[model samples]
Target: MAMQGLLPFLAMVIVQLGYTGMNTTSKLAMDYSNMKPLVLVAYRQIFATFVMIPFAYFLERKTRPKITMSVLFQIFLCSVTGITGNQVLFFVGLQKSSLTIATALTNILPAVTFLLAVISRQESVGIKRITGQAKVIGTLLCVGGAMFLTFYNGPIINIGESKIHWKYASNSGDHSSHHQSNSVLGSLIVIASTISWAVWYIIQAKVSDQFPAPYTSTLLMCFMGSIQCAVIGVCVNHHKSDWSLNSPIRLVASLYAGIVCTALAVFLTSWTIQRKGALYVSIFSPLLLILVAIVGWAILHEKIYVGTIVGSVLIVMGLYAVLWGKDKETKMKTEGISVVMPLEMVEGSKDLELQLPKDSGSNKELIANVEENGTIKSNEDEEKNLGLS
Candidate 1:
């Protein structure tokens, strides 16, 4: 039980590490190139598709998606939200605001996901359950923490420069180009990106459900993303005479974002979520703010103001609250339930077998309810067999 519980948390940690590295690297890319946000995002997706295509083929060629016209459309829709909108909005927001704040706001994914799930009738809010209450309260706390991190700022404790220094901040300071106090527009854009991301997760859940193949779904999404981003990149480069390897930083950023953040982190997540659950994979995002803060102060010479500290605490507490609620909910539903990792979705699980607890009378009734509803409505009961390993 102990090891089972730890698995999901561990997955989030791994994902966060890669994500923090990507954030730092992307910032560096902006420093090195005069490339626009669209251009960077376009190239990033192209590389991401290139990287994932061959891997998906080699790893999953036997069960790979058949590439039907309908599946192709799904891939296109996925590319729009998951790849194109998410990266474009995010980099643009980062361009206007601070990465720490961007990370803070983005950590609200679980809450946003929960909210949207409830609205879409994909999940129910068990008001009487302590776990449910905890989840709701935790989500609110996370949001509050994010707001605090962004809006409150008194003292700017100077954290020294990166190994690679940038005169950009100084030049911008002289020009007064960076002040957005929870600036409504910037916040909205980030929120939009978050919504787009939530959409990605929900859709991924469906696609994964249909194909029961995480790698295949990812491959399709990336393949379409490559085409979409390439078109945009060509458009962005139309004005330029020399598009061949202009900026090493852009190339580096695109690779790291594509291969490391998108490809590797994604596979880790699919595996972890299979081992644990989506909620588990999601909660670790808040922690990345701390990682990014450390990186920013150490490498980028960013200021660590009091507000960032306060916000971090709030976010942490709220995240735990949500997790507490989810834990209770899972415990109640655990009898006869098991966390089944679809073998095709994740590797290293083909030989693993779950030992589900014997079903109580209530559990039997619950199963009956699920079957009755299964034929009627499809929703977020991802499986009765989803929990700690």
Candidate 2:
């Protein structure tokens, strides 16, 4: 039972690690190999489809639900928001910004999703409740953190130098203004991706309700996303030669992203959601930020700023608050249901007993009849004793 409970956590941890690896490889492909974001997205989806279709086919053959038109429509919508839009924006943003910033910005996802849920009337802001208040405050903190992270770049914290110095430094140095503008743009784009992802969650919930087959849904999303991205890629990049996987880094990035990040990550996430829930999965996102920060510092030799650290702290705190609130709210609701159900059952039993017909007319009349019978027996006993004497 303990291990069963821990399985979801372990799965999510693995997923986050996979995501970290994807970020590293993707950054290398885009920055060093000069792979276009659209082309990367296209390749990612194609690879994911190829890898995931087999699992969806063989594993879910017996139990897979029939995909109706409505299900397909939902899947298409999911593909648009979750796959094509989310990944396209994310890759573009990643190219523009540092890995740490990209990862940190994603911590706002839970807050955004919560706000969306409230707006859509799927969730409530029980302001009178502490949990609800926590959620509201947490959302604000996350938003504030994101804004702070975008605009401010305080003094850089100089960590000890990384031993792995594998970089061709640009000769054209010190373009501070250019980098700043790019960072702002990238942050905004990444934030948009988070919103798209949150929207996907909402739509995917509906899909899960209708379809319930994670692997099949993922395969469909990947397939559709590949087609969508391919069209976009072709129009944007005129150079046919650019699409060639001549570079090892590009090949590795596409393969890793498609197989591990898209197919495996999605499956693991869906499985965790089945065992735990969406909120539970979302809470684990902060782990990615931590992983990215460490990896960026050590491997990429990225500099961390004071503002970045502070903003990241705020985002992490906010993410936890939102998750805690949601978890608390769910538990309270479950407890309330358990409490109300038994009370309702007891009240129903009492009402049933009250409505039952009685054998006796009344308690007072029954007692009086018993007393008169006892008096008659006593008189008979007295007469019998006198005759014997």
Candidate 3:
């Protein structure tokens, strides 16, 4: 029972871990191997489609619902927004910006998703209510923290450096104006990706409501995404040489992003959303920032700043606030149902009592006979002794 309750949380954590791995390895591949982001995105879609097709076919064949045009269209939109737009922009952004920046920016997801959900009326917003207030405050805090991290790089906190220095650590001395410009551009791109992702979440919730087959939906989405990305990739880069995956890092990054991040993560996220809703899935995104930070510091020799620490604390606090609000709302709803049920049962019992005949002709005659024979039988006694009465 405990494990069943924990499955969604565990699934979200696994999804974040997959994302963390993608962030780290993809950054490495782009930085060192000079791999193009579009190529990576294309490969990821293709590989994810390949991995998901067999599972969707065999596992869900018996249970899958017939695909309608509406479902198909939603799946296409999901492929465009979630996979194609979100991933391509993210990889390009990660390549141009630092990993810390990319990770911090991702903390904005919950806020974006919340706002979109509310606008779509999928999520309720009552400013007078505490739950709504908490969500509002949480959203503000997340956005503030993200902006803080992006714009303010305060004095570096002197955490102990990693012993295992990466080879590319010494090569990152390009702090030129051009590099700064690229970083800002990348940040903007990533922010755009977040908006796209938020829209996708809303659409996906609708899709899941209509068609609850997570693996099948994911397979279809990936298949569509692969075709779309392939076309985009061809248009962006005409040279066949740019599409080469000869580098080991590029190959590993593509495989990991595709298999773990896209195929597995998408399925888990969809299943979790169907179980717990989209906001629940979005709230777990802040975990990626922490994981990416630790991994970046340890493996990539990335420096941690005071601003990063401060901003991360705010983001975590905000995340907790949002989750607390959601939990409290759910608790209140459950309590309401529990309180109402017993009262309803009591009212129903009373109605049954009122509708019951006072006494049948035969029962009244028997009671009268008993009373006439000098048996002390009151009305209450008669009713108690004779169920009909």
Candidate 4:
């Protein structure tokens, strides 16, 4: 394949690697470092803040907004939900459950976020068509996958092992490794975290109305989240020596999560959103599950089973269904089939299009190309209705 065509594939691989790496590293750090959840949350925020503050100061110094109360409150709200709440709950959930379940549960986030937005009247479901029904059903299927991973644990063939490692059967003498049974509770915690994250996105959209500098906004969030989680961590882990920054794994994980995952990931994602739009970036992220499964098999040695395969298929199918529905809606709207008028019609109706300039320059004939009856026609070439009434 040509190098240009390979760029998107490489970008996707990198993104999925980042997701799986974050999941695995977080788990390893938690296990080896034996750190409290809130403390890790504090460290993650502190690391992210430390990394972002300098970048913001250097890059956005000329455009930084004056510190306002509303900005501060927005940052505080963002930090509370997105950073502190999301990370703390995810880490706790990961420690309690299988990484597979944690990853899959998170797959329900887009659907959940969309549904919440719709319910809040921030979004609308205008069409009651087959595509719309498919989208809704697909979202439910994604949720069902999460639920199945959490609740169902029967005799399941280890599909990953069957495909990759046929010789090795027992893992450290533990056989009931359909998944870590802790997945049941962990999935619930992560689900809550996902909701919190979706709410954070909602709040962040509101915050964007106040602050134009994305880097500065994210930096402020990290700072506030660090302080908030630090206080909570200290109180929760009182007199516990394990809460200190003595463990190398915890220190590394905190730094990685903060600097790389939070700081860099957010920056790159924001850049992509700015360039290509948010939906363009989001619709591609579900492929991270394949990476997660591979990481779980290779690093964590978590057994993948029939249910995981089936569930994953459902989740992916659901995500695509939602995307398809959205695309169809957009197409209908574009074709002027919806109640909303197209931009051209709106401009033409208001008599605002092709207004003559006041400078008294010679008028130039204008022509607009429009498609009609399977043919492209210039407005000038079309016959006008000139009969007097």
Candidate 5:
């Protein structure tokens, strides 16, 4: 039981680590090898599609539902927004921005998704409830933090020098107006990517309901994204040299992003979501910010600023506030179900007792034995375990 509970936590941690590596390596590929974001995105899509094919084919073969035109269309939309739109904008933004900023900006995804859900009428704010208040406050805090992080640098935090230095580390001393403008633009674009990702989550939730086959749906999304990205990549990057993966770092980056970040991460995320709800999965996102901050400093030798620290704290606090509210709501609903189930059972037992022959020795003994054995009390015990009294 303990292991079962721990597995989801472990899986999510691995997923975050995988994404951190993708960020670091993808940034390295673009900066050092001059790989165009579009081309890299296209390659990553292709690799992910191939990697997911076998899993979708073998694992979901029996359970996979027939793909309707509606489902196919939704998957295409998911491909466009989730993969192509999100990845392209993010990579381009990362090219112009620091790795830490790139990861930090993504913490707003849950807030974005929540806003979208409320707008779409898929979720309710329930402002009268404390849970709803938390959600609202959390969303506001996330937006405020994102804005602050984008606009303010607020002096660098002197955390001493990093012992480990990356060979591909670019000079971080450039504080020119041009560089600052680019960083602002990049941050805005990255925020746009988060919005796109949030849209994907909303659409993907509907897709999951209709399809119910995660691996197969992911495979189809990747396949569609690959084709869409390839056409865009080809048109944008016309030079034959731009398409080449001669550089080992570029090749590794693309492959890692595709296989680990897309394919494996999706698998692990799906598994973790199955075990512990989407809230639980999303709660791990802030950990990515922490990991990226460490990696950006220790490996890439990126400097941390006061704005980064303050903004990150606000974002993380808001994220937890939102998650805690959602979790509390879920527990309330579960407790309601548990409470009603036992009451209904007790009522049904009473009905059974009234219907039975009063003189029937066997039936009387059976009921007495059950009461003595405390079978119905087990339900109460469960409620106790769930903290519902």
Candidate 6:
């Protein structure tokens, strides 16, 4: 039982680790091997489609629902937001910003997701309640942290150079106007990617409600994304050389991102979301920040600034605060339902008893009973209106 309980958590950890590897390897490919971001994203989708489709076919063949045009369109939208926009922006951002910075920025996902959910009425927030207040404050803190990290480098805290420094890392201190402009643009692009990702979550929630086949949905999204990205890549860069996979690093980055990050990570996350919820999976995002920071420091010799550290701390704290609030709210609702259920059952029993000839004694008593039942119904209605049902 304990092992079963731990399995999901372990799976999530592995998923984050896979993403961490993707970030590092992708940075290596782009920074050192000069791989174009769009081309890399195009390759990722193509390769991910290849890796996912077979598994989706074999595993979900019997259980998969017939794909309707509506479902297909939803999948296409998901591909646009989640894969094409998200991956392209993220890769471009990663190429411009350091891995640690990109990873840290991803911690804003839960906050962004919460805001989107509330806006869509998929989630409710009661500003009058402590839980809602916490969530609001946490979201603000998370956004503030992201802004701090992006805008303020502060004084760099030297944490002793890596034993084996990457070639690109040795000259990472270049502060040319072009580099600075690229960095700022990349940060904004990455922030936009988070919005796209949040939109994907909302779309995915709707898609899952209709479709419910995680593997098949993932495969279809990858297939659609591959085609779209390929078109975008071709249009953006007509040079055949930009799409070359001759370099080992380029091949490795593409394959790793496709197989590990997209295929495996998506499957694992979907499974975890089924077992737990989206919030549970999202809470683990901060783990990637730590993993990437350490890996970047040691492997890529990325500098760790005080501002980055402070911003990371704030983001992680705010992330937990929001999660804690959400959990508490869920628990309270569950308890409310549990408490109301017994009263409902008792009232139901009373009504059944009142139907007997002997108990049907007084019209006055019946009117009182009707009023009490109306009160209960009104309470239930209020709960539903509050989105706590």
After best superposition, candidate 3 residue 221: deviation in angstroms? 0.7
Could you tell me every candidate's TM-score relative to the true structure? 0.75, 0.79, 0.76, 0.76, 0.81, 0.80
Predictions in order: lDDT:
0.57, 0.67, 0.64, 0.58, 0.68, 0.66
Tell me the TM-score of model 6: 0.80
Clash pairs for candidate 2: none
Q: TM-score of predicted model 1?
A: 0.75
Give the poorly placed runs of model 1, Cα more than 4 Å off. 1-15, 65-67, 158-184, 233-237, 241-244, 266-283, 334-389
lDDT of 2 by residue, 1-389 (tens): 99999998899789778878888878777777678999998998888788877877897799888889999999899889887887789888887887889888877876887778778865667777787798899899999999999889799998886676555212101222234469889989989988887777667656755675666777888889899999989999869866989888889999988776655655565566546544566666677788888877777767889989999999888878877775565345222111000001000000110111111112122111112123222212211111100
Candidate 6 local lDDT, 1-389, one digit each (tens):
89878988998888778777877778888877678898998898788778777777897799788899999999889889888887788878877887787777766766887888788876666677787788789889899988888888788897787787655544433322235556667777788887887677667666755775666777788788889989988999779888999888889999987776655655565465446544566567677788888888787767788888988888888877777676565455222111111101100000110000110111112111111123222322222221100
Candidate 3 local lDDT, 1-389, one digit each (tens): 89877998998788778777877888887777777888888887788778777777887799788999999999898888877887788777777777877777765666677788778765666577787798789888877887776667689878897787656433432321234557667777877887787677667656755775656787788788789988988898879777889878889988987776655654575566546543466566567777888887777767787877887777667766666665554445212111000000100000011011122222333322122124443323333221200
Summarize candidate 1's per-residue lDDT along 193-220 as a digit string, tens digits.
7778666555554554445444455666
Ranking under lDDT, best-scoring first? 5, 2, 6, 3, 4, 1
- Candidate with top TM-score is 5
Between prediction 3 and prediction 4, the one with superior lDDT is 3
Instruction: List ranges where model 3 is wrong by over 4 Å.
Output: 1-16, 168-181, 262-285, 334-389
Which candidate number maximizes lDDT?
Answer: 5
lDDT of 2: 0.67
Extract clashing residue pairs from model 5: none
Q: Where does candidate 4 stray beyond 4 Å?
A: 129-131, 159-179, 266-277, 327-389
Candidate 2 stretches greater than 4 Å from native? 1-12, 167-180, 263-283, 334-389
